[model samples]
Target: LLELRILLHGPAGSGKSSFINSVDTLVDAVSHDSFTTEYKTNKIQKGEPGTFYPFVFTDIMGLEKDTNKGVGVEDIKLAMKGNIKDGYKFKPASTISKDDHSYNNNPTLNDKVHVLVCVVPANTIHLLSNETVTKMRDVRLAARDMGIPQLAILTKIDEACPEVKRDLRNVYKSKSLKKKEFSVSLGIPLNCMFPVKNYHSEITTDDNIDTLILSALRQMTDFGEDFVNNLYRPTSSLQTGI
Candidate 1:
């Protein structure tokens, strides 16, 4: 019985859009029994048929290594504060401000991002450009400054490790997972990280994939609740698991 805004930030080709589609497919399968895994629509609000997510997941454009391309750090910071409106065109070198037409001058708590979920592809962690990593880190720091709780979703695990691709249950023991940089650089701990495989080639819903997706989402909601409710009452409860 809780709803919180979850903002997704990531680099290009990191599967942010695909992850949202996966959530929609999983909801259809678990709640109903019909889901089609066709090509990715690359659209937002692609979740459950005739259903809406209680908590909104805002997907911004991908970030680039330099300020000259992709999403700017300032724009992301503004987004975390819920200032940027939906469908607002992003500028590579400029960040939105109070004067921007799309800026939400008065954002409610619901409009602001309660949970910040950083999206990074597991397979490319080793190959990330230093500038990209640095820029992402800057975004993370901005979130931290505002006391916003953070979690990261490690997407495309199947492509990262063959063992994981075969059986997702073996994710924890897979020695090949690129967990170091995420844990150390982004400050997302080993426990906070949720490694998931987005639905790409398959048509049917897999329990393993669904579980991973839902589990991560569940935690996101929990943390979001923790941040929002704690604002009014700090010592409610800390035990939220699915």
Candidate 2:
């Protein structure tokens, strides 16, 4: 059993929230048509692996280059340092600082961000202007500095390739059709990238979609476990760069 904390990052409207929703749907193996009840509050959300997943996913506000909107680079640095606490609403106009109550002055291995998942929409990856790419690069370099392993999720595959849209079984083979959307152009290694489609418009679980999404989830969980397990090198190492 592996335990880790995964963070989802990307530009606004890239479907981070939708991806989380899809994963929750898959873990419970629940279809919208058969959902029996809804919990008003999610203080203790549970997942797969009997009691709950050994790991959990964290979704934060999107990143934008603008100084007055979206998550700031400084805030992202804080997140990578594991200083930001859960449920801390990100203020687009400002970044997190030591003054904030949610700031974790001394984060432990449990508080550190184990995995960094970059979510990008495949359909419009080319349209991700240099400004956006620059922002991503800045964050990537920051994560790289902290020894955090990052993975790119090239999402919205259904809208990127025709064959994949018709049938996800052709994802890897359809890379030619989706060559432009590939993360190689984004400076990320091809092996560390994944293509997935969220179930935003679906009412039922489609095996192909689940297969792709779950595969990515499993791969990310593995990467996260590696980082968390490695944190035992020394307690001081975790707080050095912060």
Candidate 3:
């Protein structure tokens, strides 16, 4: 089994769960709530045996402001610490506290996350507030701190005008300028990024949605292959008996 721990992180209602569902039909259990995933990991088998086998992907709880101060912040923190070598095992329900209604704040630095997928809405990119832009930039910074490869997926593309899509990409490119100094400080390249148009159609195949997804997947695989080859070692203890 080729286990890959891909973490999806973004603001609430950014279509994170829907993206997971697109990757694997089994993730349909996910919903559209503000916090659809409450500190849980859903595993799915990607590709076939022998060729690529089943690579594991985890759908993490969506992040929000003041998450660290909330009740579930601890759980979120813990979940974010996992890496490729030692994949995540779901936490038992009995261990969770019923009193904590706030989000989990338990992010651990040891979490071995392979990739960080940031979901952004294409239509709202230009309209985001300065604070939101800063928050998005912070997310990228956090990913860099964890040494995880990061990619931005632009969701709700079908809802945007063609001109808006063009403008969105330009906006994204310009926004990188604001983080150029930060990237330099971290010794990370700022241009290693890809754009994905997701949720183009209610029907997966309509409006060339599959083509967009495939293009995005190609970029992701390229990044993932390099990340896996350079940063991680194969785990011998990963038994397929489950």
Candidate 4:
């Protein structure tokens, strides 16, 4: 049995790493001034020992304003197809080639991304560079062509909306978010986007935060399972004769 692989890609400081830490306590050390320069896969441990959730998450270097300053679009495309291996350092100059030691000669279904999740900071969504948005769209197109399920997590909702900052429950009712505008800007459907504030300075978890994170996670697993199941589904129709 293979765990479903969910790939998270977004611009630097979008809270991709923080989101992972919030969900599974897998710390990747998020920094606004720096970018994650490696490809890493994270797993959620269950209550029991030597056991984990059925799904895993893979995070790549954050997308940047320039292709040469951050993760290459080609590299993200390669990752979607499972061409890149874990612990591989990202090189903004160029994508990994088949000749590279980190390249996977043959990636199985498990190695391929079952779900493609785009993590974007709610506060900085409007400030995203045109080049970065284009790169994101390019990666999204690749994932779509591969028939991978996709979703977008809008992180740092509290910072984006004052109402939500006061009360987490008002997240949906807050008018300041302008979900439609962001949906159009990011190229992700309004329904596919989920907004949540990642745990930052909190010494412990909060029920409200956990609720939002778990909701998104549930959808991730659901979409991932559907994608994997559909792969084995028969393309031809079955006929029954009386």
Most lDDT-accurate candidate: 4
Q: Can you write out model 1's per-residue Cα lDDT over 1-242, one digit (the tens) per residue?
A: 23578888878778776777788677653222122111111222335455566677777778777668888888889888878777677777666757877888987665678888899999888788889888888988899998899989999999888999899999888888857766886678878899999887777989999899989989988999888877766344532411
Question: What are the clashing pairs of model 2?
Answer: none
| Candidate number with the higher lDDT (2 or 3) | 2
Q: TM-score of the candidate numbered 2? A: 0.84
Measured on C-alpha atoms, candidate 3 has an lDDT of: 0.50
Off by over 4 Å in 4: 26-34, 236-242
Residue 175 displacement (Å), model 3:
16
Off by over 4 Å in 1: 29-51, 234-242
- Encode model 3's per-residue lDDT on 66-181: one tens digit a residue: 42422233343344464222322223232244333332344332234666677765555556555445555665666676567877666765455554355444434444323344
Model 2: how far is 215 from its true place, Å? 1.4
Cα RMSDs, all models: 6.3, 5.4, 7.9, 4.4
TM-score of each prediction? 0.85, 0.84, 0.59, 0.92
For model 1, state the Cα shift of residue 240 in Å. 25
10 residues in a row with least lDDT, candidate 3: 83-92
Residue 78's C-alpha lDDT in candidate 2? 83
Give lDDT tens digits, candidate 2, residues 16-125: 76777788777554323211111011111465344666677666777665668677777878877778887676777777768888888997766667888888988877
Report the C-alpha displacement of residue 73, candidate 3, in angstroms.
7.8
